[model samples]
Structure formats: C-alpha cells, structure tokens
Target: MGIDDRAPGRPRSREADAAILDAALELLIERGAVATSIEQVARRAGVTRATVYRRFPDKAQLLIATIEAAYGDPPPTQEIRDVEHLLTGWASILASPRLRRLLRRLYGAIEDFPEIARAYQRMLGQQRDQARRNVFERARDRGQFPPDTDSDVLLDLLTGAGWQHLAIQPDNCTVEDTERFLRAVLHQAGYRPDGYRQQLVPQGQQPARPGDKE
Candidate 1:
C-alpha cells in the first residue's frame, strides 16, 4: 500500500507486503540487524526482489519500516479516573509473558545497535514514556499520589520493577507475585484500590470482584 502506483498488469500485492514485513521482524528478533538482508527477507517472504524494491528502496528503509511496525505507536493516553483503573491497566502488562520477552529483547540489545535503537525510541519509546507520565499526573491530581510526588521518578520506579522482572526476576517470580509487588509499590505511593473503587460505586452497589477488599 505504501508503494508507488503500479503498472497496468501488476496491482500491488498486500499479501507480499505483509509477508516481507513479518519475515523482516522475525529476522530482526532472531538474528539482529547485521544478519537481516534484503535477499534473505525476500526469500523468506516468498517474494521477488522487485516486490521488495517496489515497497522499500533499500535494506535500511525496509528494516526501519519493520521495526516501526513491530513497535507500534502507543495508545492515546486516557484520564486515570481512579487507582483501580490504573492498577488493572498495569496488571495486564504484568500478566503477559510474550510482552515481557519482546521488551527484554529490545532493552537488552539497544545499546550495541545504535541505528535500530534510535529508530525504536523515535517510534515507540517516547510515546510509552509519555503514557506513563500521563497516568502518574492524573493519579496525582485525583489524590492517589501525594501532591509532592514526582511522576517522573515514580514512572522510573515502576519501569524499573518491570525491567527487573524481565532481566533478573523472570525465573524467580510468578505473575501473581509480580502483581503483589507492584501493588505494594502503589501502596507506598498512596494508591489504595479499595479506597478509590468503593467510593466510585453507589451505596447499594457492591464491588464486582473480591479484589475490592483491602
């Protein structure tokens, strides 16, 4: 779809385009940038060299597009209405091992490969950092964090916990344990899910899950 207008007989093939991107991403994760070549990608994708050339002028453009597609733009930041919503948002990340692996691979390799590193940060890293900042700021405004709380520092601490889980604690901790550890961190930061969610419900309506209990 990103290619220039095609000649009369050959309309661009979306399937080939996707196959090339998928193969490129797999190679990027498996072998790193140096080993990911246009010929190899085209072979793995089951496409001719011309198909790849039509979509991307060179290996650099192809690989950059692959990295961008892999690390998608972050979701739009939402208002953090309460501690419970924020906790649930984070709990989902802790629950995903695949996400943990992808993150660890990126985190582990960035320093040695400067071009891919810069491209990744430009594509997804800044957006993710801003999303964290937004959560912390909204939480602070709602009294989940103290007025003096440094959202940036808090973000680092939270991200640090994730990094620890990815690199150091992957074998040592279960997902439940990770959630408990994060909850403890939030508790220290003045976030109490029971306190926030219960207040949001009407007097007669009970909290849907047992997690509402302190």
Candidate 2:
C-alpha cells in the first residue's frame, strides 16, 4: 500500500526500479504531472500498483525519483573550462524534448500541488549547489577565477537567475541567448572570458568591419 509496507526479507529488483522510473518519466512527459496517475505509471511499467507503492510512498516521491533519473547523477568530474562546453551542456539538456515537456508539466503542476512543487524546488537547489561547487573548483584550478571568489554568489548570478527565468518567463529563451547573457554577466564579474565572443555572435550575422571598434 505504501513504501513502508513492503514485504520483509526480499530485495527489490533494480531492473524493476529502473523500469518504473522510466515509465514515470514517459507518463510525466505525455500527460503532465496533473494527469499522470500512479496507476497509469504501474500499467505502463507492466507492474502492479502495489509494486509502485512499494518503491514510492506517494506521487510526489515517484515524481522526484523520475526527475532525478531524467537528469542523471551530477557530473563526477570538475566543471567545464571553456564557455563553449558549458553552454553546450546546457543546450543539450534544454533541447531534450522529454525534459522540455517535463518542465512544462512541472510548471503547471506547481499550482495545484504545492508540496510537490516545494520538493522539486529543494531538489533544484541541491543540483545548483553541486554544480556551483564543481564549476568553482575547476575555475580555481585553471586560474580563471580568484581563489577567494564566492562560488555561491557567482552561481546565483550566472545560473540561478537563468533557471528562475526559464521557469517563470512566458517566452522561451534560446539556449544561445541565455548563454550569451550569462557570459556577459560573468565576464563583467571578473570571470575569465573564453570563447564568449564567438558564442555571442548570432548565426549569419556579419562581423563588424576592421574600423568598427568604435
């Protein structure tokens, strides 16, 4: 009936767990969180509702697990050095159809399910914190950022605002545009600018002539 009510002695199957999480993501994308029921997820996974319950205490828990699965574990390595790599990684994530759909669903569901919204907000905070630490550590190693730079503040200025804008803004900002804005902000904040100029130029836009420095 619930996560706490699982039978004693038997270990849960990792394969089954993966299958359920996969199904949950599919349903979340297809139907949005408001329409994605646990029963539907169970059917999609070819498992009983009881099994789904065994793994997750509630819909909120199921959603959390599904989100994590979609996002994957945080990068174990250091932060990206070049702005190109950083922007590329974010572009890849935002360009995913499934992730876009999930985000849309999450935005809609937040109104009706405040608790679920709060849980997701907390998860996003954790993700941002980890990312900031990794990025700052790499920046320090590369001598791009001062050793004493406040990673939390830098992350807030560069990333946290972008995330909030994506979640709240009515218009869909392109990944290139977002990255350009971040690059400018970071550059002004004293972070080294690598590959930022190339990234900011829009495709097919003619470069300024030799005397255009004015």
Candidate 3:
C-alpha cells in the first residue's frame, strides 16, 4: 500500500512522526548512515518497522528527511533574495552544534554512501541551486559582479566557505561570528549588494579580517 493511503480525512500522527525522525537522527549521529537501519530506528522510536517503511520506503529517504527536519522550515524558493539572504540562512543553520555534527556525518557519507547524496540531490539540490543561480543572475544584472561571472563556480566557492567554517571553527562559534565570516567571503568574492555604504559591512564595523579577534 502507498505511504499516503489512509482513512479519508484521517490526520497523520504528528507525535509518531516526531518520534521516528528523532530516533533516526540519533542513530545516524551515533552510527553514521551505513549502520543506521529502519529496524533500529523503529525499536528506538517504539514504533513498528512497518511504520517507518510506510513513511520512507528506504533508508536514503529517511536520512534525507531527517536532514531536512534539521534545517527547520526552509525559505520558499521565491524568498531567496541575493547572497546576503543566503549567507544569513547558512550562518543560522551552522550556528547549531547539533546540526553541525549531523552535517559533518553527512559530508563524510558523500564518499562511503553516495546513494544518499544522490537522493538528496534529486530531491532538493537542483531546486536550491536554481534559486542561488537566480540570485547570482540578479547580482550580475545589478553590476555587483562582472557579467561573465559563473554562478556555478561562485556557488561552489560560497558553499565550500560555509563547510570550511563548519570544519574549522569551534562548536561554540557564535551566529554573529559566522555571519561575519560569510560576509567576508562574499566581500572577497566581489558580492556587494547595492547599499548606502560599507559594502556588506555593518555600520561602524570594519570587515572581519583573518585571525582578527572575534
């Protein structure tokens, strides 16, 4: 039977969904993606294995859903403004130590369990990339970047900067600190949004420099 097949108008159990996702996240963090299984999650969540299987046919989808939950409510594609918006969102997510650990594990899984990565890409990657590309295209039109700037490479670099922050910075890194680092990266990349002044720098605050006291 399909996962969505239920009595007409019956509400899906939010409590059950929360338990299952929480259980799956704990397992993934503890054992990595390779060792986490629906059986294990079901036992931990105190639900039947069939319950998890109904919601997620396979492990990849379950893991992806867990990661998506970690992200909280994502902004609609239409609300993705320029690089500043992206940086703010990225910094907010990186500020969470729990999410940082989850992301680290997922990053490691890219090589060992490529299918999960592929599944995520198929589900969410293309849509997010297109939104970012639109941001870049608008920036180009506004003359913030050179017309020839390649959004793909720019996107890659920006993404790598976030990961580097995650991998390098201490778990206690502040959201303000993270945003400063992200803005510095965008500034370096010539991403100056049309502003009154300061070029992405906050009023009266100089751009953050490498090794500056945070």
Candidate 2, residues 52-159, lDDT tens digits: the string is: 988898999899889878988554343565545665666556545567667777777878667777886675656655765677657755656655677778766766
Candidate maximizing lDDT = 3
Which should have the higher TM-score, number 2 or number 3? 3
After TM-score superposition, the amount by which residue 4's alpha carbon in candidate 1 deviates from its true location, in angstroms, is 14
Kindly list the per-residue Cα lDDT of model 1 for residues 1-214, writing each as its tens digit.
Answer: 3242356677777878789998888876676676678888988888777788878887766877775565452343444545556666666665666445555556655565566667646765677667668877877777556567888888888777767766665644565777787778867766644334424666887544324455
**Residue 129 displacement (Å), model 1:** 2.0
**lDDT rank, highest first?**
3, 2, 1
Clashing pairs in 3: none
Q: Estimated TM-score per prediction?
A: 0.67, 0.61, 0.82
| TM-score, model 2 to reference | 0.61
Candidate 2 residue spans exceeding 4 A from truth = 1-10, 75-86, 121-124, 130-154, 160-190, 194-214
Q: Write the per-residue lDDT of candidate 3 for residues 60-147, one digit (tens) a residue.
A: 9999988877677464353687777777888988888988888889998999889999998887888888899888888877777655
Which 10 successive residues of model 2 have the least lDDT summed? Answer: 192-201
